[model samples]
Structure formats: structure tokens, C-alpha cells
Target: MNLSHPHSSGTIVRCRRLLEPALREVVSGLHPWGARMVAFAMGWAGLDGREQDADGGKGLRPAITMLSAEAVGGTAEDALPAAVAVELVHAFSLAHDDIIDRDELRRHRATLWKAYGVGPALLTGDALLALAVSRLAARPEAMPYLSAALIELVQGQTADMAFENRPWSGPDVVTIEEYAEMAAGKTGGLLGAAAATGVALGGAPELADRMWTMGRDLGVAFQIVDDVLGIWGDPRLTGKPVHNDLRRDKKTLPVLAALASGGPAARELAAVLATGAADEESVRRAAHLVEEAGGREKARALADRYLDSALGVLDECLPEATELRDVCHSLVDRVS
Candidate 1:
């Protein structure tokens, strides 16, 4: 069953309708081979280059960018450049992540690196990142925010990869504080840029800092919710195999929380992880251990806390942020 959030459904639909055309136009301008790979990656084209009316995710980042502008008393059109730029950056990251994770599928289809060769797919990601930065050239004021966000994004991804190599039961373990910082870098940085750029475009340069705070908190909440889904979400909804993160041995927030508990269940969970290859039964047992150790609840509470902070900042900075708040709540409550 689809997760329902009646208050935000119509708004989400409207935002996607407004954002799709702009995204398509930007993608259509890429070089032929690069365009084909990216289009395939985005579900907009088949491997054979036929057109497809694909469901290109929730368009959450772009929608948030546009909404941020509206919150600052400006029209959605004012933030279009920032919205497109961030969307491109997001796609670029996904293309690279698919390669890094060795993920064969994304959005229920073959990943770019799987369909095309890894070399081409990597180049396609590079092209997309270049396009994303180039798109901001017209808005010189937005450049600094995007540049800083990109740097943090790279740093976060590097840390995430390094975390995977650390022994699950070793002394040099990943801590909750370190995980939070990585989450902020990997996920929150771009979100902060999106809001800040939108605010600047909205003619409220003074409120840009506040919007960055809102975006960063929301981004942290977003990653936490994503971590929850990685462990417990239905495969039909999330478009991946069941117990996906466990199978990959990803060091997500829930798993880290379980490991930190130092209780019997947490110990068992760590032992299971140490085995390295997480078959279905092992994954199921590990997930149960995480829950037994209160990891799931702890992760949920952390997500809610960040979301509350984000909403509080939104309320203080923009009284007219009802739509944005609804969207934020809906995102945090998402199952997929």
C-alpha cells in the first residue's frame, strides 16, 4: 500500500508537473551518448533509446527548492535555476553511487553502470556534474553555495566508503556523532545549498542563512528516514530486494545504533555482520536483533528530532511555510 499524506499529495503532484519540463529540457541538451546514458539512468529512455514517460522519483529536492523560494515570498519561477541545478547534481551522485555500491538496479530498472559499461557510466556522471555546475553560471550569486555543498558531498561520500572497510567489532569503530556528520555532509549539504540559493533568488538575501539551517536539518531527517526504509521498507515500495542494506552490509544509522548498544542483541548483530555475507536468514535475524536492541526506535526518534528542529526553523523564518512543512513531514513519513 502507498503511504498516505493527504495534505501534501496535491502539492507534490503540482510541483512535479511544474518541475518535469525544466528537467527534461536540461537533459535533452547533453551530447548524444551522454544524453542517452543519463536518460536511461533517469528512466526517461530505454536502453535502445526509445522515449519513456518514466516516474523519475518524487522530485523532492527540486520541489523543496521551489517551495523555499515561495516560502520567502517569491514565485516558484524565481528558483527554477537552483531547482534544476540541484536536480542535476542529485542525478550525478546517483549515477556514481550505483557504481560504488555495485547496485544493478535503481528505481526498479538496470543501473547505468549495469546497462552501459562502467567507463561510460562514470563519464556520464561526470558530464552530469559538469552540467549541474554550468547551469548555475547564469546565476552567479548561487555559485558559492553550490561549490561549498559539492565539496561537502564529496567528503561525505568518501567517509561513507571508508566506513565500510572498518571492522564491525573493532575498536576503531564508527560513532553516532561521526555518522551524523557524514549524514549532514552526504545528504544535507546540497539541501542547504538548495534552500540558500532559493532564498537568494527570492530576494531575501538576509534569510538565506536561516534557510540553510532548515535545509540541513531536513536533509538529516531525510537520510534517517531513508536508513529506516533501507532496513524495514517493503521491496515493492522501495524497488530493491528485501533486507537490502543488511545484504550489502551498509553502515546505516540503524545498524550503527544497534552496534553501539553493546547489549546481547547488539553483540549478536555485530557477530552476524562480521560473517560478511548476509544471506536472507542472517539478514532477517540481524534486523530482528537491531529491533531487539531498540535501534529502530532510536533511529526514528532521531529522525523526528531533526524534523522538529527543521520545522521550528521554518516556522520562525517563514510563517507561510505551511506547504513546505507539509512536504517535509510527508518526506520524513515516507515508506519508499
Candidate 2:
């Protein structure tokens, strides 16, 4: 888990090239205003309903789909529909997540709720979710996996919101294992389904089942890395402010791990968060306390453990899965 591993832009660039057109086509099929709003959420259109040249997301879920297909000896073209569907699912989740989290920005731009109002943003998210299912309806095999993933995603989101309010209004502190499970559902479920559907549609059912485990592990690892970045990542690279998670008092992995430690630093962290209103200086101190309490190392080790497990699954299933391995490694090492 060398955090210093060089970041590479190549894999994401290739993924966008393969996926962008298909994504655009799906959004274009929506009702005109709905299409504009969804496109705005996707960084494709401005608040004024005009197309923009801004960069969108990393397209990581679809990349996982295509790479998983390729790893099982299928062409990316064979998995294009599944890739597009999963990418749409990911984008839909983000649109709603921003509203739920009250986040004001994404990809260095204003969040949809901030720019266009919550009603339009919520409707836009719903539109994308419907489009995701409709896009894959022609291939009924993809539906079961997609449906199950959506259920898990919603459960995860519900748990996340519940965790936030439990302290002031309810009982019990969030545990580390519970946080990991939430991450698994919110993040891993979709990636697993993406891999499963891609390989199954590409003519390999057995391989698809095994790849689901690999993808799930990769997705959990990816979320842990995201948690790290939320605390320590540079704004220039992450498009987020420093100590963003700490500022919000979000129950991310490192924070939970630190709280679970029960050390002096953890006690300090608990005191700061008990107020539920952290100022900038308190957020910075919380970051140091989380690290000094060994939360950072614990989170990194867990991420590495999951990543290694994913690699092992890939090895057993597809020994020649170099491309998939590279993509996973790049995600593990990403600066943003």
C-alpha cells in the first residue's frame, strides 16, 4: 500500500473514450428538460442548459465492467451495454448523494442541487435511475444483478443517513465493521454487479460469479482509499477541500477506526465530534488525532488486504488479467 505509487491517467482516459458516447446517447433519450438536468448533473451541460466541455467522472464502474469482460476473453464491445448501464447507475447515486450530503460541489463545479435547486436535482437523479434500468431491459439477464445491487445501494444509503443522526437523537456509536459493511453495500454492490453482468453477457457465467467477488473487494478497497483522500487529499487533485470529511463529521472508515481505538487521541477526537459542529482548526486537529491514534494505518492496511484478496481472486479466475489488475492498482494508488 505505497501511497507514493505514481498516479497514471492512461486507463481512465481510455475508459472515457470507450464509454462517453454511449453515456451521452442514453441521456439524450430522456425528455428534453430532464435530459438537460441529468446532463448537468453529469458535467455535460451547464446550469444554463448549454453543453459544456468540462470533464465528467472517472468512469470507474464502467471501466471495471469492460476490463472484467476483457479479462474473461470478451471484447469491450461485447460488454458495452452493461458498462453504460452501470455508469448511469453510478451517476444516479452521486446526484442523490450530493443532495443528501448537502454537498455544494463535484468535479470542481457546483453540485446540481446548488445550481438548479433540490427538486430538479432529485428528479434528475430519478430520471437517470429509470434510464439505467430501461437501458438494460432488452437484456433480461442483466436485470437480476442490477436489481439486487440497487437494493443493496439503497440499504447502504439508508444506513449511512441513520448513522449520522444516531448520536444526538438516538443511541449507539457507529462501529468500524458497520462502516465497512455500509461501504460494501454503497460501493461494492454496484461494482460486483457490473463485473457479473459484463462477463455473463460476454458468454461466461462461471467466470462472472467469481469476478463478482473480485469486483466487490476492489470496490470496498476503492471506498477506503476515498475515505483517506477525504481527509488528506490535496484540493488541487481531489477537487475537495482539506479535511473535508473531518469538517462534516462524516463517519468514514478512518474516523470510525480512530473512535474504535479508545486511545487518548481517540478520546480527543470523540470530544471534538460530540459537538457535531467542527470548525476548521478542530478539523485539522481531528486529522492529526486520527493519524496519531493509528486510524490511518489501520484503514490503509484494510484497504491493502481487500485489494490483495481481489488480486488473488483474479489470479485464480483469469491468470492473464493484467489489464484488470492494472486498473485496480491504479485505483488503489490514485491521488484523487
Candidate 3:
């Protein structure tokens, strides 16, 4: 979901100027005809599709690419191929994620599944994944790290499906530790891989995993911000209605905390979330009840904790990673 005011437009512009040319050049150089075919399949046929999915992202992966290169004394230009690959993989995930979550709108328009239909969306996602691998493979220096990143990225997706389908058969109340574990697989997996791949591209295998973990921690914080926006964000900014998360009966940090608070609001919030029995008024009441029960405060605090953890990991993992470290700080400290 788009968070209403949190996107850093300035940073995004910087990323675009840094990434777009490199992405295009690498794609063209790799397997000319094949790359265009894959892009067409993924609905990147023109500016519209590209902007809808790829253009509007936070550029976290691109940031990792650039920063990792700098961390190891490589120019950002040298890491363009890897950066393009990271963006492709990230785009693939978003396509499938929208379908799985049944979110009709993306970047304020119908998602690929809605616009072109599910079959196309699925095929497109697969194509993008293949394209990402091809980009990495085409660049010899980035291959080793790229392979490992793919493994973790795919495994994380598996873990995400497992979480939604079975949920560990535990209490409905999502624990902080449990949420962190899930976030690692869902968000951390790709970010970690992207960061580590950058490190490897810079010829520093010794620091790859450390870079990955740093990215993972940053991703966890990012996910927490997402959960917060899912529940309380302005509809105008994020392009999702209030209570969308509650409507889906999905587990989020705030909802889980409200459930565990043991109060009337917590009790009612639990009932409504469990059965989806509420009308509009009822949903409003449940939200109010959750705040009365301290869920709001708890969610904010949890987000802060993860942010701290991510910064701590960055400090330790990349002792000399100024560029990477700066990007990490910027992402976790955002308030838009």
C-alpha cells in the first residue's frame, strides 16, 4: 500500500537520475531481443506500465546497489547492471503481491491483474523474475552474489505464503518476535539479497552477508511503517482505504497488540476482526477501541524498536559503509 506522505520525492528523483539509463543500457546490452520480449510480457511496453509499477517505488534496491558499490570503492555506474536486476526482482514481487492481496489499485490505477487480468499478471511476474536472473548472469562480476540472493528471495516468498495459509496455528495475537520473523522473510529477504549482491559486485564477499543483514533490518523497519500506514494512513496519500487491513482480517502489529491488551476495546476489536461483522460505524468504534486499549502506542513503539535494531545492525555489519549506512538511516528515519 502507498503510504500517504512518507515517500521522499527528492530521494526518488536522485534514484531515477542514477538508475534509469543504467537499467535501460544493461537490458539492451544483455540479450537485446529477449529483454524487450520479457518487458512486453511484464507490461513494461511503455511509459504507463513502467511508471505504474517500477517508476514509483522507493528505490530501496537501487539505493542498496549504489551504496554497496561506493562502500567497496566502486563507482555507482559500475553497479548499474546489478541495480537493474534488483529492481526487476522487486517489481516481480509487487506484481504477485497485489494479486495475492487482492488489491485492485496500484499507483492509483488498476493493478496488472485487474488491468490485463490474472493470467497475464502471473506470466509477467515470472518473466520479470527470469529477466532479473538474466541481468545478473550477463554481468560476470555480480553472478555469485546474485545467485544466493535469488535463493533467499524465493524462499522468503514461500515463507510468506505459509504464514498467510497456516499461520503457525498459534494464538491470533501476533507477537513482536513472530512478526519480526515473518517480516524478515517477506521484506528482509529481498532487501538483504539486494544489499549483499551489491557488496559482492564490489568484490567484497567478506562483507556481502553483513550488507544483506543490514538491508534486512532496514526492511523490517520499513514493513512496520507499512503496517502502521495500512491501518491509520490517509486514504488520499496511500491509495488504500482506512481499515483495508482490518477488512482482510490480516494480522498487523497494532491489531495484534490491541488483541493482547485485555480490555473492552481490545475485546471488541478482536470480535470484529475475527468475524468481520462490523458496519461502517462498527469499524470506527473498533478503531477507537483499539486506541483506548493502547494498540496505537504499542505499534509506534514497535516500529521504533525495529528502526533502532536496523541502525545497530548497520553500524556493526558495515563498519566502513558510509553510503550504505546513510541510505539505511534515511529509509528508517522517514516521516512522510
Per-residue alpha-carbon lDDT of model 1 for 60-176, expressed as tens digits? 777788888898789888888888888888899999988988988777788889999899999999988888888788777777778878997899899988888877877788888
Q: What lDDT does each candidate get?
A: 0.84, 0.80, 0.67
Q: Ten-residue segment with the worst summed lDDT in candidate 3?
A: 46-55
Instruction: List, in order, the clash count of every candidate structure.
Output: 0, 0, 2
Model 2, span 1-336: residue lDDT tens: 122334334655687799989888888888898888888877788888887976577777787788777777888888888888898899889899999988887888888889889999899889888988987888876677788789979988898878776551123888767887888788888988888888877778777667777777877898999999888877777775667666665788888888778888988888877776467777778888889988899899999988899889878877887766777777777778
Q: Judged by lDDT against the true structure, how good is candidate 2?
A: 0.80
For candidate 1, what is the lDDT? 0.84
TM-score of 3: 0.82
- Stretch of 10 with least lDDT, candidate 1: 1-10
How do all models score by TM-score? 0.95, 0.93, 0.82
| N/CA/C clash count, model 1 | 0
User: Which candidate achieves the best lDDT against the true structure?
Assistant: 1
Scored by TM-score, the top model is 1
